[model samples]
Target: MNELKISILGTGDMGGAIATALSRRTRHSLRLRGAQPGSTSALRLIDALGVTEASKEDFLASDIVFVVVPAASIEEAAAFLNGYQGIVVAVSVSGSVGRDGLPSSAERIATALPEATVVSAFTSIWSNVIREPGTSGKTSVFVSSDDDNAKEVVSRLATELGFEPINGGALSMALYAEVMGMFAVRLAMDSGYGRTISFHAFNAG
Candidate 1:
C-alpha cells in the first residue's frame, strides 16, 4: 500500500493511541489535531508521538481522516469537516439516535458530510488494545461502510496495524458494531478480563 496522508482528530486516549500505533507500524504521514484547535493536550500529544500537528486545511485535505472524538461531539466534528471530499473513518459510536433517525454514528457523519465517503471502524476495539495489538493476537476490527472502496482502505489500515479487519457488511451493520462495542466493554468489565482484552472470530469450517 502507498503511503497515505492520515489525520487523526481529537487528542484523547483513543486518538493518541491510534496515532502512536500507526506511527510505529506504518509509513503513513500522520497529523494530529484536537477537537479544539491548538489545545495544549494536542500539542503535547504531537510532541509525545513525534508527529506533526494538523491545521484545519491539513486535516480536511488528508486522504483519510479519523474522527476519534467522543460520541456526544460527533455533530461538532462533522460540522468541522463540512466540505471535506475524502474518506472519513468514523470512530465514534453514539448510542443515541441521530438526525433522520440514523442509528449509527457513521451514518450520521455520512448524512452530515454528503461529499465524503464515511466508513465506520475502530469503534469496538479499546485504545489500550490498539496500542498493543501483538498482545492479543490479531484482534478483529469490524469495518462497515456503504462504499466498498472506502471499506477496503480502512481494512488495509487495520491489517497494517496488526488487526484482522472483518467485513461487517453495509453501513447499516454499523448499528450492530456499535452495540457490540458496548457489549464488549460490559463483558470486559463484568467478566474481570480487563480493558486490554479483545474479541476474535474463529471460523469453524
Candidate 2:
C-alpha cells in the first residue's frame, strides 16, 4: 500500500497508543492532534514518536483521521472536522441517540459531519493491546461503515497494525459493536480477566 497520511485527534490513552503503534508498525505518515490545543500529552507523544503535530489544516488534510476522544467530546471533535471530506474513523462510543434514531457514536459523528465518510473501528480493543500488539495472537477489530472503500482502507490499517479486521456490516452495526466493547470492559473490570483480553470470532463450521 502507498503511504497514506493519517491523523489522530486525541492525545489520551487510546490516541497515544494508536500513534505509537502506527509509528512502530507501519510506514504511514502520521499527524498527531489533541482534543484541546497545546495538549501536553500530544506534545509528549509527538516528541516520543517523532510524528508531526497537526495544525487544523493538517488535521483536515489527512487521508484518514481517527477521532479517539472521549464520547462526551464527540460534538467538539465533529465541529473541528466540520468540512472535512475524507474517511473518519470513530473510536469512541456514545449512548445518546442521534436524529437518525440511532445511538451509535459513529452515526452521531456522521450526522454531525455529513461530508465525511464515517467508519467505526477500534472501539473494542483496549489501549494496552494497541500499545503492545505482540502480547497476543492476532486480535479482532470490528470495522463498520456505510462506505466500502473507506472500510477497506481502515481494515488494511488494522492488518498493518497486527489485527484481524472483521466486517461488521453498515454503520448501524456500530451500536452492537459499542455494546460488545462495553461488555469487554465489564469483563475486564468486573470479571477479573483484566484489560489484556481481546475478542475473536470462531469459525466452527
Candidate 3:
C-alpha cells in the first residue's frame, strides 16, 4: 500500500497513539507536531518512529491533518493554517462537549478552515485502546462529515488504524460521537472498566 502522508497537530497520548496505529497498519508517513511551545519531546518521539517532526509549514503539506488539541485551541490552530487547502479531520479526543453535546470547537474549525474538509472522527475511541491491540480486538469510531470524500478518507484511515468506522454522516452527528467518547472515558477513568471498551453492533433481526 502506498503511504498516506498524515500530519498530526498534537503530540500527546492520543496523538501519539493515533500516529502509532497509522504507522503499524498502513504505509503512512507521519508529520507530527505539538501545540505547546518548544515540544522537543514530542518531536523526538515521532522522529524515532521515522516520522518527521513537523513545523507549521510541514503540517500544511500533508494530505490529511489531525487536530488533536483541546477544544479551546482549535480555532487558534485552525487559523494558523488558514491557507492550507487539505483534509482537516478533527479528533475530539478530549471528551468535552458543549450544550448540544457537540464538540464546542468544531464550528470554529469548520469556519476557520473554509477551504479544508473538516471531519470528526477518532472521537469515540479512547487513546489507550489504540495503545494495545489484542487478537481479534477492535476499536469502533464514529465519523461525521458533510463531505462524502472527506468521510471516505477518514473511514479508510480508520480501517487502516485497526478501527471499525461507523458512518454517522454529516457534521450534525458529531454530538453523539463526542458524547460517546466522554462516557467511554468516564467509564474507564471512574469505573472498574479498563482503559478500553469494545463498541459492538448486534442486530436484533
Candidate 4:
C-alpha cells in the first residue's frame, strides 16, 4: 500500500510507542486525536515526530483509523468515529471482559459504530516488540475482522511493523484473540517472565 492517511486516538503509552515505531518505519501521514492533543507528549510528537493534530473532520477523513485507548474508553473511541466508513484497527485490550465475551474492545467498538469496518489486531504483543525489526524473533499478531479486505489491509500493516499477522477468523473470533492476549499477560505476570516476552504461534509445515 502507498501513503495512507492514518488517525490514532489516544496518546498514552501504547499509542506513543506505536507512533514512535510507525514514524521510524513508515512515512505515512499521521494525525493524533485525543482528549489532550495539546498535551506535552502530543506536542513532542507534533513537533519532533512530524505528527499533526487532527480535528473530528480530519479524523473522519483519514484512510485508516487506529483506536489505541484503554478498554474502558472503547465506547468513547467509537463515538469519535461514529459515522466513519473506513477501517478501524483497535489495538487496545478488553481487560475486564469475561472469557468468550462477544464484544471485545474491538467488537464493542464495531458494535458502537456499525458502519465502520473494524479489525482486532496488534493486541497480543508488547509495544517494545513492535518497535523492533524482528531480528531476534517475530511476534505473532492476531487479526480478526468480518471484512476480509480490511483484514488484509491490517495484515499488510502488521507485516510492515515487523510482526507475523495471523488470521483469527471472523469478527466474533476477536473475543478469543483478546482472551489469548490477556492470557499471555497473565503468564508474564505470574510466571516471572516479565513484559519482554511475547506469545507467538508457529505454523507447522
Best by lDDT: 2
lDDT of 4 by residue, 1-205 (tens): 6999888888777777778777888877888866665877677677767878888898789888889888888887787678898989988887765654447888788889898899999887776676664466778889999999999999998888888899889988887777777877887899877676786789779
Q: Give candidate 1's TM-score.
A: 0.93
For candidate 2, the per-residue lDDT at 195 reads 87
- Candidate lDDT scores, in order, read 0.86, 0.88, 0.76, 0.81
Judging by TM-score, tell me the better candidate of 1 and 3: 1
Better of 3 and 4 by TM-score: 4
**Residue pairs in collision within model 3:** 3-27
For model 3, how does the per-residue alpha-carbon lDDT over 1-205 read when each residue is reduced to its tens digit? 4566788887888888887777766787877878754597577666667777777887778899998887777877887787878888888544347455444355557888888888888876778777665565566777788899889988888877777888877887776677777777778778867677656443579
Q: What is the Å distance of residue 129 in model 2 from its true position?
A: 0.8
Greater-TM-score candidate between 2 and 4? 2
Give one digit per residue, the lDDT tens place, for model 2 in 1-205. Answer: 7899999999889999999999999999999889677789999998999987888898788899999988889998899888999999999965443334647888889999999999999988888899887655788999999899999999999999989999989998988887777777878999988887788875889
Query: Is candidate 1 or 2 superior in TM-score?
Result: 2
lDDT of 1 by residue, 58-151 (tens): 9778999999888888888888887899999988866553333656888878888899998999888888899988563788999999899999
Model 2: weakest 10-residue lDDT segment is 93-102
Q: Which residue ranges in model 3 land beyond 4 Å of their true spot?
A: 36-38, 93-104
Compare the candidates by TM-score and give the number of the best one: 2
Instruction: For model 3, state the Cα shift of residue 7 in Å.
Output: 0.3
Can you give the TM-score per candidate against the true fold? 0.93, 0.94, 0.89, 0.92
